[model samples]
Target: MTLYETIFVRRSVRKYDKTPLDDETLRGIQKILDEAERIDGQTGRFEIVVGSRVKNATAPHYIFAFSEANDGAYANVGYVLQKVDLYLQSIGVGSVWLGAGKPVESAPDYVIMLAFGKTEVPLRSGAQDFRRLVLGEISDGDNAVAQAARLAPSAANSQPWKLHFEDGKVTVRYFGRGLLKAMLKKMNKVDIGIVLRHIEIALLKEGKTVRSVTATAAAGGGDLTAEITYVD
Candidate 1:
């Protein structure tokens, strides 16, 4: 399935077969990690390692994401890795985002990791399988982009984003919730980038060519926002 199609059925796989993937498959994943798109002007790096290299191994492999410590950097990690996450599932490999997982050899800039391996777990049937906010709650336009992006995953399922659509442009605004706002601040930024990827995919599926993707901090650092300008 195409990444766009996989977005509708992808699930966060947890139980993975312990066997490692073939060397060729592992190299393909590494290539995706090296080439995944990031938020404009941000640079993040990813490393694929054996599951034993991770502190809590759930799969036979893990990809450790590293970046500078900032909102844009964290968001860039999400933008880049979400593509890899979708690609893994599209190829019938199981994958999950591990926010709390760690590399056995830690680095100062370690951001997040994704766990993956073979699995007997199945993908969800369709959109009905996702427990996400209604389009009306998270987005202004009840269109294909909104529908697809509504399923973008967030930390603790916080769903901390609102979408606005204008002619040839789409904007994602972050508005975090819950009493753990302070604790989840970084993750929320990452969540915004995850939705940004979904928005781009939806636009592409509709025959739109994205002109640019940009991120900006709200006034007084109150919120985070990303904008995508596109042409048909």
Candidate 2:
């Protein structure tokens, strides 16, 4: 499947071709994005804003993904919108997550923005193109799911997740502390969301379903963000 192939080849594209996406294509993308799996109980919204109002880039459009100001909103936004990112790349559209860009918002709660448009850069050729942590460093075990999670993108390339699988549930644990820990908390959740997206797509490609994902404590008793159970 192209979506599965996109998982391995997609990369953040900053340069755009300046040609705005057509209305049909935009509507199609919006519809596809609306089908994205969101975190349970995490309420959010998405808007397509075009023009020079968005600061810091020249893309033809910006996808403003945000949630009601809350503790885990940013992570939720990251989780949901990455589906759009992958979808766009799979169909030859280019995009980049804009963590630092500011939008002219009517409200003060816009959490994250993605700059998207036409571009000439090709989909990544293979794993060699990804500047990411090795599989062994991120997971205690190896499998198709773990390999997908290993390729998830993270803030500042700080891949904070440590995975360990037992039975059918996969536990995602993190590492950090103090002020740095507090700062990376949101980013870590974003990382988990991204990783989960990878795992979800990987499993779906094999005719399996992710039954449920729940929060739990690590075996040694740390903050395990989630435990996902899948059925084939």
In terms of TM-score, the best-performing candidate is: 1
Q: Residue 7's C-alpha lDDT in candidate 1?
A: 97
**How high a TM-score does candidate 1 get?**
0.97
What local distance difference test score does each model get? 0.89, 0.75
Clashes of 2: 0
List clashing residue pairs in candidate 2: none
Point out where model 2 deviates above 4 Å. 176-184, 214-224
Evaluate residue 132 in candidate 1 and report its C-alpha lDDT on the 0 to 100 scale: 84
Quality of model 1 by C-alpha lDDT: 0.89
Worst 10 residues of 2 by lDDT: 215-224
lDDT of 2 by residue, 1-232 (tens): 2777788999988888888899999998899778877766675888888847686557999888767754345556767787888899988999887767788655577777788999998888887889987888888989988888787777666777788888767777665433556666656666666776777777788787788754433466455476567876
Superposed Cα deviation of residue 149, candidate 1 (Å): 0.2
lDDT, model 1, position 24? 96
